[model samples]
Target: MQSELIHDSDFGRYLEDFKEGMVIRHWPGKTITESDNNLFSLLTMNHHPVHLDQHYASEATHGQVLVVGTLVFSLAVGLTVREISGRAIANLNYSEVLHHSPVFIGDTIYAESQILSVRSSRSKPDRGVIKVKTTVTNQKGEKVLSFLREVLIPKKN
Candidate 1:
């Protein structure tokens, strides 16, 4: 007997669906660990004591070890790539990056992205520009990171 097949829901968005002011909240939150902070800091050549040394970080404002800022930013951007611009032709630029709050170890993070603008490319008829604002929040509902980025995506035929 032959088995039936099932298809999973698609996570990627089509070009026509990229509308201005559209917001998309990504699923699958990730927790930051002490080890994660240390490893990321070491791997990226960021030897900041605030991220690596718990004793030193404990004396800081938050009184605890904080996650590397760049790591959190990278994670937030990575989370939205699949649904927003996994098939992007090119990344144009990034702007208005703000670090609203510190991300501490053991904090779970999730992200949401809002489509700020979309414009058809005059030179490349088959591609278009998409500008989006991404915000990342910690488990305590604190906004840790936010940024605006632009990318080029292929048009749906």
Candidate 2:
């Protein structure tokens, strides 16, 4: 017996879909939870008291447990995966990562990205690279983190 394949829906954009100066705002922001912070911290082998110990963080400058910056960056990247890197062959580089403000456990994070450049690969004509600047903001619209990432995506033939 032969098995039949059902429908397929593509989740990400190809090389030909990107344009310079184009902005993409990701939807449905994620709220940071205490467990989320703790688990991420522990999973990454980061045992900083500020991210785990409530009493310690209460006495710190922020007066609260700060959500790990790396977690925020990861969330930002995840948020863009469906729109930015869904069809990516590889992630080439990540640079200029900057944390601008504090993120707490209850903060809802949102992300937006702007295409900085798109160039076809000279060696491999079937693929291309895209550079984008992503900005992550909190529920209050305050910019919390920003960075640049380059991804290689295949072109539509």
Instruction: Judging by TM-score against the true structure, name the best candidate.
Output: 2
List runs of model 2 lying over 4 Å from the truth: 1-9
TM-score of 1: 0.90
The residue-by-residue lDDT of candidate 2 on 1-157, one tens digit each, is: 1211212336888999889888888876899999999999999999999999999999999999999999999999998898889999999999999999999999999988889999999899999999999999999999999999999999999
lDDT of each: 0.83, 0.91
Cα shift from native, residue 78, model 1 (Å): 0.7
Best by lDDT: 2
lDDT of 2 at 133: 97
Which pairs clash inside model 2?
none
Task: Report the lDDT of model 1 for residue 103.
Answer: 86
Compared with the true structure, model 2 gives a TM-score of 0.93
